[model samples]
Target chain A: MDYSGNGKQFSGKVVTVTSGKGGVGKTTLTANLAAALAADGQKVVCIDGDIGLRNLDVVLGLENRIVYDLVDVVEGRCRLRQAMIRDKRLPELYLIPAAQTRDKNAVSPSDMIRLTNELRPEMDWILIDSPAGIERGFRNAIAPADIVLVVTNPEVSAVRDADRIIGLIEAEEKGPARLVINRIKPAMVKRGEMLSMEDVLELLAIELIGLIPDDEGVVTSSNRGNPIAIEGKSKAAQSFRNIAQRLQGHKVPFLELQEDGNLFGRLARLLRPGGN
Target chain B: MHAVLIKPGTDRNGMEISTKFQIKGIREGLLVTLGDAPWEQVYAALIEHLDEQRDFLKGARLALDVGNHMLKAADLGQIRNQISERDLTLWAVISNSPTTERTAQTLGLETRLSKPKPEPAAQDTRYQDGDPAILVHRTLRSGYSLQNPGHVVILGDVNPGAEIISGGDVIVWGRLRGMVHAGAGGNESAVICALDLAPTQLRIAGVIAITPQRRGKSQPEMVRILNGQVVAEPWNPKKKD
Candidate 1:
């Protein structure tokens, strides 16, 4: 008795990117993952779940194309397809921008589940950018997720917050969330000034899905409203591409952080002059 | 000790009004008595009342007296789950039916309203017990708080941003890095202990302390207020402080 009338054989996997703390690159990871997935010819839609603080559109460079936002779709002011702003460069990518005026309570968890279900048939992946904190916004973002990617920096505070978020995810039974350690400065970690990948893993015991090194190009590309994963040549872009591959069940080896600043690594750096 | 009675009211058009459940504070948490009506109506009314008083009744233990109602195990289990989802523990089921009592017993609920047992000696602290204690088995996350007027014991890590406020001693079998306040009702002798004690903030009665930055690995530590100041020391059962 398959009573669900929406006769669709395929449904996209909903992945939510969330961090308990603000300024930890949740939006950046969502935008880049969407871009990388779309570049791989997968139809991806990114729903900005940060209501009233919507920036995924700006990060994805689809701000100007948003005629109707998520609030419109939930409020019955427009159709779900009408609010989907398709990416011009990547023909398979789309952005469902959050409403700037309404807050997180404007849409409930059931509403998000319905919206993602409606878009499930036509898409391959739905990436949601969750707002910071363990409140209504985070609940809404994770309600429809098949996988939750916890993005965190290699700092004590961020890792602590990520641990708390992981506990909450497990409490909601959406757990065993995969981890993404973003903005790792290898030089600082080598100097023992910053928390290393192992240190972060020791506290938050979760599977590591991606490790993106600190790159200045990410800032410039985000400023220009373009995701670095689209066509950038930085190691950060390659890391995102590897993450996308891993999401598609590809076994990609993690990038070596190159933290050994000894004579051997120094010689290698000197010979190549631009080694990561 | 007396049974509560309720009379149905009449509407403006002279229609009979449906009587709902009543909630009253008792020595043991709250006593919620269902009215003499259909099971569905009484259950719905009870849920509606609980929802309406949610803010005032969070984390309160409850004793449900479903008078003479011969409810099955499924019915009792469903109500218990609903009450737990509202953060209220249904500790006892005071029923007049032996069938209902057996059903409640199968669900691990007490069939009588006995006085809650006092917790055994916790760590090295003594207490003038008043409020009933609660034992939590899962990790407390950020934005999640456990506030009990009695003692609180946790079996998992208390991550940063989580909080526990208790009137008695606070004990953690795992790491404790969150904020905790023992002796919240001003019992200065209350103590806090954890396997790896490194809380963001710790309070005992009127004393407050922050964990100093550790340069070495963490160990099982206990914290208490000694002379108007909070201090932490390794918990060794063989040695005296």
Candidate 2:
């Protein structure tokens, strides 16, 4: 809660999570990643860049603590500290909720650059949850990012939109973006009814950072406004934590996500630990 | 009636639009340089000048050099509509500010004008012969477009949403998965060749064709107009057409 360590000069790395298609897990990943990083004792801040359609605060379980939003800080209506709401559980984590009534055009890309620049020196990580299109909101979120994480589902349409988003990020010189495939069903993939990790990776041709399996715990946790990465022992939670470790420059192997509970599967898991 | 005389030594008589606007002839029609006035005053002067020389400026391609004025998308969109209504095409918008350039790009307007290059002799003699072709070495990602008056050769993949439009032949050394149009200026003899020829849509001259899903591994293929129908043939080195 105390941000008065101005003498410590820790410039934070800004990471923006964006997906071109709506209903992708951009907000969810941002919330969990911030929580996981904060749980590791790293000071992190999450900014909801989707102005008119804010969801990061709700996903982070900090919707009730909103005193001032992003637009209030950008438009100079409030100071930066007043708009940042600290998480109840993790003292190192903060949330800057978006203004629900204001549209995307209310905030410009330069304003986002200026805002993140002000927050860069105090925190260890600044995560921006981008809106679902390649328009003003997406541009605003990526303008200040040192790294961009493109989240996508395993479906064809989501992958197509993710391709477009990756191209746009490359065009804006913020690429090449790391990929995080969410809501993947390993059972369906095994049955050849869904896209496997290899298929998505071949099409996207980007570096893979995280591969999250489809879990019902994610939905339940979201409804309860608690991130699954905080305490849950689900595979999805472990994937988020592994991604955080990867972002921190640790070499963590990808999790093997096959749901076959046979002896061979268990032996394979033992043979190649964290092998995909 | 104040007779605004066009300046001498210029090829076009509509060279001088006004004091605030300087219009000159370039390879791509007219290039207008706007003065360092406020947005409203400059816009007013531009519209007035365009209206005054309506006859001579009709159907002309214009490239506006807007000095450090940081105009938004709405401002650029309004001026583009106005120019289009006056029968003048605004092909490019040159700006000193990065914000304005990005706004222009988002509106699908070119921000830079390529310098005029020497025309190849084959372009004037025969359309099928070797013409000056541009070589792009990088992958054309989605939302990126490459258009040329001659031929285009890409050494990388053309992803799903990218596009390539050429007046002559189109050749891809790598996969061609996006939309491509060859002989866009109505030359049917133009052909498109790719290592893996699976495009969302392909057009040559006035004919359009879509590739069906390949059952197995893809091979190098060539597509062209054969007997008034677009046909794809395997690129055989020994076979001569």
Candidate 3:
């Protein structure tokens, strides 16, 4: 569990969480994963790659304390350490918020590479929160990633966009990217009303890292500027912590989300004996 | 004309600027062919040339023919931004390098200057006798496209959102779920066949058809123009056409 670097030759692994479709819970997942890793005693820093529409700071509840942003570091207006705001709860966790006033074109891919290279020496893990779409911002977020995690909802459109993003990643030689299915509703999936995890994995053909069930507490905790991974014991929080453990080369079993239906449905299934 | 010749002579640093590029007007817009120099030098010269002719080349749809330059996504993306800053739309990028072509396609830029050419006239017996075919061994994922003048034989799955446009027949040894246009050049004799013939859309010459959903497990099927309508039937060895 100790990923801390030795006294010399210490470099962190950069993991970027990206979803081609918007509002698929990328910022939420990034915040929770950072919190989970930091809670595990690993030094983690999260970068908000979405410039004009920054949300990672707000999600992590470090919005008001941010004196400098990522653009300031890239443009040499502020030192790299000056822009990183340490979390109040987890002393090991830090966040480098995006510039709200600048657009995506403000930072180039090489700038991102340089910035992450500067942060690699001191941290155990660096996670980048990528914006939606396969544009400049997405490219910048993924430029320096040692691992890419693609998040997608089980809907057809989101899966389609994820497919496109996976293809692009392959073309850039950044793959094979891992899959993280967020906001999954097991009840609807069991009723044939939504796409199952198998359906998504069949199309994407990538390794699965985590399956996070839908939880309302996730939204409330995010709104309260506290990540669920640190504050709540919800399934979504456990899912994020499991993913962090997996990233650290630990073997964690995937959660059995299908058994999370209503009590009556579970009893009926148990009585029916092998009746799906 | 002579005054324009001296424009690309030398910079203030006394560095000889080799701004060798040819600009031609095409149906789409301007096609700029850059010479084989170092990427940095050529890029700087191209930008300088554009800036010099700002009024003339402004608002033009440009297709750059970068000869054999193995450009990556970062390189292509940078040039795209530079091109856009000069008020030009970079729609396509023509390159001899496969890596560069794939990079351009991933960025949603066109790799070919024109669509697949129409088939030659019926009287041209030479072309009919020697129709070429290209064999692809890898799976064609989403957002990837394959366009050929002759037949296209794929040994892998054609996922949805991918496409194939061929002048001759199209055959897939694996599952086919993408769009396939056989007889793209008005050859109605072209046939499309696959182990799983569930394509997003199928076309033969000028006609297009959507494959009806299958009831049971999929079987090998072939689609062709039957009486001016596109029809698909299971491939039966003993049955006569």
Model 2 error, position B102 (Å): 13
Could you say which candidate leads in lDDT?
A: 3
Better of 2 and 3 by DockQ: 3
User: Candidate order by DockQ, highest to lowest?
Assistant: 3, 2, 1
| Candidate 1 error regions (>4 Å) | A1-9, A259-276, B1-134, B185-188, B225-229, B236-241
Name the better of 1 and 3 by TM-score: 3
User: Candidate 3 - CAPRI tier?
Assistant: acceptable
- The order by descending lDDT is 3, 2, 1
Q: Tens digit of lDDT per residue, candidate 3, span B1-241?
A: 1112323366665655644566777778887877787888778878987898899888999999998788998788778867876778899999999778867977778988886466663733223665788888867778888887789999988888889998889999998888999888888888999998878899988999987776666789999898998988898899775
Give the number of the best model, judged by TM-score: 3
Query: Candidate 1's residue-wise lDDT over A67-102, tens digit each?
Result: 999999999999999999999999999999999999
Model 1: fnat (fraction of native contacts): 0.19
**Once superposed on the true structure, which residue ranges of model 2 sit more than 4 Å away at CA?**
A1-9, A260-276, B1-91, B94-108, B111-130, B238-241
RMSD of each: 9.4, 9.2, 5.0
Docking class of 2: incorrect
lDDT value, residue A215 of candidate 1 = 94
Worst 10 residues of 3 chain B by lDDT: B1-10
